[model samples]
Target: MIRIRKAETADAESLALIGEQTFRETFGAFNTKKDMDEYCTKNFGTRIQQNEIADKNKCTLFCESDNRIAGYVQINLNAAFGAVADTSQAEIQRFYIVKNLHGKGAAQALMNAALDTVRRLNIKHVWLGVWEKNLRAIAFYKKFGFEQIGEHVFLLGSDPQRDIILHKTF
Candidate 1:
């Protein structure tokens, strides 16, 4: 059975570990080792995870299967990319699942819980920035009704990459 729950500050270490692992698994091949290492070190520390988990404006959800984390989603209610003009919008900041569990139902379950939270908060729209080269992730977001609205620059170390901004209006 799979269970989804809000992530707490106490889960900081686990979140950091999974965050780094899943990020590398997803994007490592497309990036240089130096860039990947720099990005991971800057973004996926336990202290960063703890601070994010404790932010009242953000919601972090974890999926557990057999008592171990299988996936996670992070949503930010306080901000959105400039494309989404509505102040009533939320951003799907980060979403990831274990690579081995990709074909399983974990991603769907995590998305369902995230959308449920959006509905509960009465958010008018939801948006996210996906790497332009990440076709798999873009397709997954499209399946969830997110449409490309614009583009933005995403920095991975010193690399400036394009990210497709997508939004779904409720």
Candidate 2:
């Protein structure tokens, strides 16, 4: 069974590990080792996670299986990054599940938690960016009722890549 819960500051280290592990597992083969190493080191550091946990505008949730973190999702409550029409918008910053748990309903549980959090916050809209080349991830978002709205450039280390922006209105 997957248990979804709000992440506390104590989870920073675990988040860092899972964040890097999942990220590398997903994108490592597509990119160079230098790029992956740089991105992971800069973004998944424990200190950064600690600061993120302290941010009031961000909500991070973890999905646990057998008492270990199986996945996680992070949302930016003050999202205005892309073509948002109003203040009733939030961004699904990062939604990642371990490779081993990809098809085991962990993602669904984590997504449900994110949507519940958004609805409880009275945010009527949600959006996220997915790499254009990542068809699996795009399909997953589409299955969750998100639609393509726009495109933007995302920097993965030294690489400038295009990310298709998807939006959903609750």
Candidate 3:
């Protein structure tokens, strides 16, 4: 069974590993392998994930199975989703499931946990951004009732791509 829980500092390294593996598996098709490697190594390093875990405003959720982290989601209540009442709004900055566990409902489980937390806090809305070329992720977001709110240029590797912002109203 997959268990979802708030991430603690102890989970940082595992979360980082999951981030790197998931990022590579998810975006490898849209970017060169070298670019993916550099981006993941720089952005999802243990220190970064650890810092996020240490931040009180930042909420990180981990999906564990057999005591090992399989995937995770990171959210920022103050930054991404716009300011509002307690739990009324939150920005889902990052959501990822390990590549090998993609179809096993890990992502959905993690998302449900995040949204449940939002609802518990009386949040009325949630939002996230997805690369335009990541059709799979876009569809996944849509499945959770997120709609495209807008588009913007995203610098990935040496090239620029469009990112579609999506949001859901609870």
Per-prediction TM-score = 0.97, 0.98, 0.88
Candidates ranked, most accurate by lDDT first: 2, 1, 3
lDDT of 3: 0.81
Residue lDDT tens for model 1, 1-170? 78999999999999999999999999999999999999999989999999999999999999988899988999998886776668898999999999988868889899989999998999999999999988988999899899999999999988999999999988
lDDT of 2 by residue, 42-103 (tens): 99999999999889999999999999998899999988755877779999999999999988
Give residue 101's error in model 1 in angstroms: 0.6
**In model 1, which runs have C-alpha deviations exceeding 4 angstroms?**
none
lDDT of 1: 0.92
The weakest ten consecutive residues by lDDT in model 1 span 77-86
Q: Point out where model 3 deviates above 4 Å.
A: 80-88
Tens digits of per-residue lDDT, candidate 3, 32-128, equal 8777777787778889988989997789998887778888888887654333333456788888887778788888899999999877877677877
The 0-to-1 C-alpha lDDT of every candidate, in the order given, reads: 0.92, 0.93, 0.81
Stronger candidate by TM-score (1 vs 3): 1
Candidate 3 weakest ten by summed lDDT: 79-88
